[model samples]
Target chain A: MEKAGIPVVQITAVTPVARMVGSNRVIQGHGIVHPLGDADLPPEEEKELRRQLVQQALEALKREVKS
Target chain B: MRVVHYLNQFFGGVGGEEKAGTSLEVHSGALGPGRVLEQALGEGFQVVQTLVCGDNYAVENMDELSVRVLEMVRSAKADLFVAGPCFNAGRYGVAAGALCAAVQAELGIPAVTAMVPENPGVDLYRQELYIVDSGSNVAAMRDVVARMAHISLKLVRQEPIGRPSEEGYISRGILRDELVERTAAARMADMVLAKANEEPFESELPVTVFPPVPAPPPVRDMSRAIIAVVTDGGLVPLGNPDHIPLSAATIWGSYSVAGIDNLEGGNYEVAHRGYDTRHVLEDPNRLVPLDVLRELERAGVIGKLYEEFLSTSGLGNPLGNSRRLGREMAQKLKGVVDAVILTST
Candidate 1:
């Protein structure tokens, strides 16, 4: 939709899964349980997994060209 | 001509169950049961060296054992390698069979072994190496060793040995010479007659299936587009707590992300069947990385991201179901997303 001039956003739980599912745009997250963050696990681990997942998602949004 | 012989701990005079942990060692001259092979082969063939390893040792460490055995064969300068008349002992039979196969594959040697038909190894390695049928217990030792030695002699001498069945060994299923019993025309006529009579007829050929391809949809204007991202990867609720069947997935569910920034933890999960779900379950971001797409959206890489992410389990699902699911998903997202990306596990 973005390629043709529409606004869009993508969210995902796992970085590897997203890579395999390759998209012109993407978002990264910590995991599948709590894509943003599960209340479980050490706050750091959850925060890291979530931070990475969200970071990938944000990067996916910036791709202006779709190849 | 030099020959190498392999034997189990018991046959090598290394004791019984107590010696099961014995390691491999090379000894010159006939040792234990190897003496039988030496006498059977006569003065023309010398059992130059005997390589013995416990059956358990070989089975538990196949790679290491094979390397040691191969090194022994190379150093012994043996022209022929013969393994056990393993009888019905499963581990021993398997070890002997495996060693023979490894020797043949690595050194291009004509290797031989013997086993009772009931030994599981007979069925497993029969096609890969030469295996002679023998009595089910050690009592058949003399006869089995003699037969194996005889076959090895012929192989070493490069003499003409008959087919496996004629030579009293298990059939290796290798078609060496195709002897035509009847002409092609005669066989075709017999086949047609059998078919006409409604009798079961085996065709000399196979039938091929060529399915018709569906026509592609008309191209849409690139300017005004509604693109969708669809996947059969089964991304769903974190609780998946939905418990979608793994292999035979027949259901599909869509999670609505309308008015949402991105898929959040506890909100989404992966239902893909082909891989370990632990990682993706712990963090749903693994399956659908919405954060990256959100960033791309901010940068204006594309116009819009589809509101709902489509998902289904892809593991072992029939091609028919996949095709139907693909077409249905495409139809549903047709006007919503101008172009689409489909992901598989």
Candidate 2:
């Protein structure tokens, strides 16, 4: 859908495929499953990590894509 | 070169949907798009006859229609068969694709058609025929005709078709063996040097890329929308009951969070092998983020979350496999969720 103009933000640890596939917006995933949070962190810290990542994605959705 | 061109009733100037049920008819000389293409194919080639049929008729009676179309091609002594850059018209696209495949197989004549990438006919016949990339409709008539004619002429003259990008056609999924002068070692060294110099060098093996999908229009409003979270991190129900593969996975499983606010320990585990799963296993929310999402839901930054999250292990997958999986997942999610956040590891 990114090609057709849908606003899609890929959160990925695999940046190459994301770029190769031409995602319009990509946020580097922190870890494989730990996309937004490190499992090793405490609950409050993990929640904060998750919040920041998701907020970034929300911000990405609002950004204008020139390409 | 004698060319046989196929057209739907509308394109042959027959009529629109009212004429869609019309049977087959043969028009001598170039007609419709063929007329546009004639000048492009130039002096040596002639569109011997144009075959007009109803889009409905051709698809409904594919077997019979194929026989009839092929017979016309034989009688015309066609050296080439050209169908529509049918654009995005589904029925016409399929008919064009089907007839081209039939003519090529039966008459030993190369057939060509044009279509936008999303056309279902592309998926069905791209490997079987030469398909020029076309716009969604007749507005692209001139450009589509030009490319089709160019490719058709090369086929009639038995000239080698170069890379799809060079030929302006979709890849037939066939890798041609070219005799490059450089040894494998030499080519690798050259590529490495070019990379080190930050220069662009095309790969020896070009990846067969799929057509880009039209982006679904953005969700108009986030607060009123139901957002769904999907991951390729391989988060599955306890014990990985569906047995999704660790790599090159073709299967995807959807697990319901339902009323759950966050994934608890022992209830979920990471099945992916491409990365360390130990951290994820300790706290499944690390991947799924139901913990944070629930907070958003409570704060009303967004609407409800979909009860289920879809999982697939996408590591080591071919583009075709991944494309299919993504399309399938999107199809299922369509109309149900207002937006999607696809997290991939």
Candidate that would win on TM-score: 2
Name the regions of candidate 1 deviating beyond 4 angstroms: A1-67, B180-345
- In candidate 2, chain A reaches a TM of 0.85
Mark the regions of model 2 whose C-alpha exceeds 4 Å error after superposition. A1-7, A15-17, A62-66, B1-6, B16-82, B87-111, B115-125, B132-169, B184-220, B239-243, B269-271
lDDT of 2 at B77: 94
Q: Which pairs clash (backbone N, Cα, C closer than 3 Å) in model 2?
A: A1-B215, A4-B214, A4-B215, A6-B215, B85-B114
Give interface RMSD for all predictions: 9.6, 2.9
Residue B117 accuracy (lDDT) in model 2: 80
The global Cα lDDT (0 to 1) of model 1 is 0.67
lDDT (10s digit) by residue, model 2, range B1-345: 888899999899999999898899999999978988788889978898999998888888989989998889999999889998688888999999999998999899989999988787888788878899997767878988999888988888899888988889987778667787879999999999999999998786776564554455556667776877788889999889899998988988889988998898788877778987877788877777787888888888778888899898878986667767777787777778776777887
What class would a CAPRI assessor give candidate 2's docking? acceptable
- Cand. 1: chain B TM-score: 0.53
